[model samples]
Target: MKKRVWRSGLMANQGFNFQKEHPGIALCGLDCYACPRYHTIGSSRCPGCAGKYFSEKHPSCGFISCAFKHGRLESCGLCPEIDTCNRITRLKTVIKDQPGYPSYQNRIANLIKIKGTGFEAFADTCIHKEALLKTLIDKYNDGRKKAFYCRAVQLLPLPDLENLLDENAKKGYKSVDDAALAVSNSLKELANKLGIEVC
Candidate 1:
């Protein structure tokens, strides 16, 4: 049997499993499953945002939608007008909570501006997830004392607002408890292990 080279858009390492030990947590608003990066990595499951996609069956992402539709942003990072971007602005809160988020977002922003797609850099990061995880863990621990280590935040499948409403008896409410929180905890722990300062 010939090996299947996973190719959604770009090239990637065959047999790479993105969801190895990850717990369910929606790290970003984007659907990782539809992301060309995840597709190329052989992940049938969306890294995060599966629940939302499952509900619409179209994988409607607030970030992607806003970028392509509302903001007219080819890419979130490429948006010439960042002030008009609610999606990126919303993410700012989440990014601010984590030590490593600003840098990551800036890096992605830079990549999006310079490189057409952010997936190439993401794919490279995924290629070294383990090493990166370890490094981040160390940095987290080290940063704790000084309070400035950027820990890797875990991304998981995000349930759509409809799904959340449905599960919540259609009250149209969602909370941190609605989705899995362990993934974030794990990511935080990993950062701590790496000696990254985190609170």
Candidate 2:
């Protein structure tokens, strides 16, 4: 069988501009842009969970299939059963143990926020968060910290993240090393408070 490729306009180098298209938000509330796969180049690229591309790649994706069966809603948040769905609970349990996966709890939270605030507002929030995350990635990320940083951004409130970014900027750091050192403990503390793993 030919390999299936999900084609979302959001894939890097796939002619989709995330900042312009806002294609990073998935129906399950996964921030496709924040996933390392989304940033990957070449054949490993993913257009995100909401991408126009669908294939046998995820034959067991209950979220996708369920959404399709239920009026083709853009997100599970639209479903009245969202809070009580067994599939979502099962998926969350599976995702929680996966290292480097965006926080499942966070995904649900994003879904609720999206449902309450509307896609346009949610997309704007995502874009702003991405910008902040980019700043951290540019200034503090080493080869090993990418996943940790992504998780941190996902778990931290936007205001807290913005404050951290501002704090770093105010410190006049001279190098990535310096910036990382300055924020490492604080990041760890915040992660711990949220009961999230940073490593």
All candidates: TM-score: 0.30, 0.67
lDDT of 2 by residue, 153-191 (tens): 766778878887787787877777777777766788877
Q: Model 2 Cα displacement at 59 (Å)?
A: 5.5
> Model 1's lDDT to the true fold?
0.35
Residues 112-156, model 1: lDDT tens digits: 433454534444343344333333333323323211212232231
Which number leads on lDDT? 2
**Whole-model lDDT per candidate:** 0.35, 0.67
Candidate 1 to truth, TM: 0.30
Error of 1 at 113 (Å): 9.7
